[model samples]
Target: MHELIVSPFLGNHLVVRPGSPKGLKVPKHRYLELQQAAEADGAIPGWLHKPVLRQWGLDLRGQNARPALLVRDTVSHEYGRASYEVNMACNWECPHCYLGLKEDTGMEWSDRELLLYLLRDAGVLWLQLTGGEPTIDRQFPAVYSLAYELGMMIEVLTNGSRLHNPLLLSLLTERRPYRLTLSLYGATEESYDRLTQRRGAWKAFRRGVDAALEAGLPVELSVIVTRDNEHEIDAMYDLARSLDVRTREYNNMTPTYFGSGETLSAQALTRGGQRGVFTGCDAGHTSLHVDPLGMASICKVARDKQLPLLTEGLDGLSKLGGIADQALLRQGGCSGCQLSEQCSTCMPLAQRYRQANAPLGSYCQHTPKEVTTA
Candidate 1:
């Protein structure tokens, strides 16, 4: 017999069955039995059973037998990787932006010092530089250079608003195998401007994209679903294809704690309630968010001070035990969702719902309700 423990975090149940070198084989009937037992004992929510079963390879009809938990502690350890968000200053004011606030003035040396301490101490080998716009940070090159010196694989998420700076472009060109994730607000100027709420932003973003391409940087484009531009998804996809870029990644516009949720909701409702309930989130366990203040949060959208698992130093992080044990227990709205597979339940989206005191209006024309249905 294997001892299986189910812990909830960010609305998903992490099933840990200890002492099983081989993953445990769980049949549908047995899972249901566990669910009923837990529910009767007030230990688990009924809503969770479906998603957990689905995640463990149990079919909807509950007919599948012997769904095993294929466990490899070594594999699990390797899956545990360290990631950090370097900064939170961006150049654009897109309505769906989620960095909390804009501060183009750049980070002080003290801020950089804290970042360096955290990165070094955490043993972070993979890093992500995100911001209101990371390239807009005057110290971005310094930050990038330090990460490179530390031999960390770096990924940058930007709006492409400031990619044309010659020095910045040169730095990126000199860095080999770096990834640039660009946010495409719209496929055309009319839609783009409306989404970003800034005139000439469209042109600037285009130039930035071209510059990144010319610099030979590996680039990936992300698009946020909003009411004003749902129809343009295919158009953006076509544009990415034309640029010899990969497919446009789609994210549901989530509101953050800092005054951006209202704008995101307005855009979502205007787009005919395309955004809906977020059912699944993988923060705290597989992914983590580090704020500009050096606080480690389970999700970027939910910047709860109480959930700061790690402060701004590697020493603090190491003292917290293994990264796997730091997984956050799920709470609030995410606790009741059933569509763990199809829904985009992230911190930013959760923050929007928290701000609105209601569910996010739909902005995803491409996501059918059935896809997220329980």
Candidate 2:
């Protein structure tokens, strides 16, 4: 007779049943709910001796599946940082936007909430919420509040168009993000609107930025460096300084997942044209990216491919490691190059272009030509 077991791993939660074709990666609370329900019905979370798994030729790292004796990690108590694309659907299609404008094929709201609970259970200390625009999601409030209640530090990247939203602003003021990074397209409204291609976006953005500051939410600004707005770098700093907020200057924009430069317009410069070598990036180890539909990937650059964490359970997770390994491997000239620290190659950017045989899109003026010449 086959038995049912619930185990949580560092990467995923597994509910596996012997002889079953598939299992689910359940959320933490739901898993706990199942635990309580089992206890009520008088059954311990199923556990077999470690030898049983080896005997069956099964190789699995169950984070916290405690048998009468604990072996491997059965349940994970370690948490770090994660950035979820709350939803990929967007109102604005920025020319240089990485993910490109696409329908929300990501997970539904219900499942996302489950992921959040599971994330909390996994001990995630900081959570970054981003999207086509996270505030556009109807279920944003529920998700945001749940993460906040979990005591996770929240970082939000947004266009600031919706900060003035009454319900959302109210939620922001109450729960409050640890930091809100606002995208500043240009210093002037006309220039900003031209870049975003929205007629009244500057107004909405201004309103949102003002609203966030007025509500006492910590705010920072990112000046996107593109042809249309590259000249406004100093002005952007002035703007940030005037608002008494910190600023980040962005020069690189990941190409569309297809690795085509279709989205790259004059306003969006290519920041990866140099012959730089990939050193390393913080995709798999330090940070993970989850898209709208519960598809998890190592980073934003790898968004097109994702592991279905909930459906395939442990098998999906195991495969995900392989994917990250393949992605993290130093490809091309980077393998022999010693200028990794100086090379302009961003791992994600290199990975994005290498598979497609596509040329790196644009060159950073600051790239040291001699260093990458190798």
| TM-scores of all predicted structures | 0.63, 0.71
- In Å, residue 82's CA in model 2 sits off its true spot by 0.8
Question: RMSD of candidate 2 to the true fold?
Answer: 12.3
lDDT of 1 by residue, 1-374 (tens): 11234322222324533211122334445445555544444333344347656544433243221222211111111112344555555546666665546654444666666665455444443467776676766677888776655444567878887888888888776654246888887789999988778889899999999988887778888766577777787788888889887645555554555534555543543233434545554444445566655566545554544234333344334323333233233335444345443344443444456666654333222334433322
Badly placed stretches (over 4 Å) of model 2 are: 1-79, 266-279, 313-319, 332-342, 355-374
- Considering summed lDDT, which 10 consecutive residues are worst modelled in model 2? 63-72
Clashes of each: 23, 12
Using lDDT as the measure, the top candidate is 2
Please report the TM-score between candidate 1 and the true structure: 0.63
The regions of model 1 sitting more than 4 angstroms off are 1-87, 104-107, 258-260, 266-282, 285-287, 306-312, 318-352, 360-374
**Per-residue lDDT of candidate 2, residues 245-269 (tens digit):** 9887776655577576555564444
Report the CA-based lDDT of candidate 1 relative to the real structure.
Answer: 0.55
